[model samples]
Target: MNDKPAAPAFDRHMLEALVCPVTHATLSYDAERQELISHAAGLAFPIRAGIPIMLVDEARQIKADD
Candidate 1:
């Protein structure tokens, strides 16, 4: 049996509608990292099991160098 979990598939339609919870700005999808990046908020929201966790508390703070 395959023990590895399948990668979450992001829906384009949903991505188009998602925005930053903090800044309320448009979000950009990072397929490689499976995250939704909010340049305005400087945070990256994680996508788990094909579901986007848009909570500000759950987001990762992004550094300027990153």
Candidate 2:
């Protein structure tokens, strides 16, 4: 059996339905970093392979300019 779970496929269109868990603001996708940025909240939600990790506890705190 595989030790790690496979990443789920994230549909780009689905981004429209996603909002920042903290601020309830829209998110912008960073293709290079594979993350969803919530500038309002100053947080970066990581996108693993394709699936986005939306949990606030798992998100990385980011600088306003980042």
Candidate 3:
């Protein structure tokens, strides 16, 4: 499954200015999944093509332990 080309790196610096839309809390980067994890919001905002999709509707619903 590791056949695809590596994706563009997400700018880690942007994390400083970005926050979870739902909770207005800090988000953590999940590099492996290319997502921004919002623990407070219980969602994982996906990063596609090096861009973070902060919209709640586009986020994945996550379990507490996830």
TM-score of each: 0.84, 0.81, 0.88
Native-structure RMSD, model 1? 1.7
Q: What are the per-residue Cα lDDT tens digits for candidate 2 across 2-66? A: 68985666688978999999989999988778899999999999988788999999999999888
Candidate 2 least-lDDT 10 residues: 1-10
The residue pairs in collision within model 3 are: none
Error (Å) of candidate 1 at residue 10 is 0.9
Cα displacement (angstroms), candidate 2, residue 32, comes to 0.3
Q: List model 3 lDDT by residue over 1-66, tens digit each.
A: 669987788999999999999999999999999999999989999999999999999999999999
- Residue lDDT tens for model 1, 1-66: 879977769896897788888878998888888899998989999999889999889999998556
Could you tell me which residue pairs clash in candidate 1? none
Alpha carbon lDDT of each predicted model: 0.87, 0.89, 0.96
What order do candidates take by TM-score, descending? 3, 1, 2
Which residues of candidate 1, in runs, are more than 4 Å off?
A: 3-5
Give per-residue lDDT, candidate 3, residue 14: 96
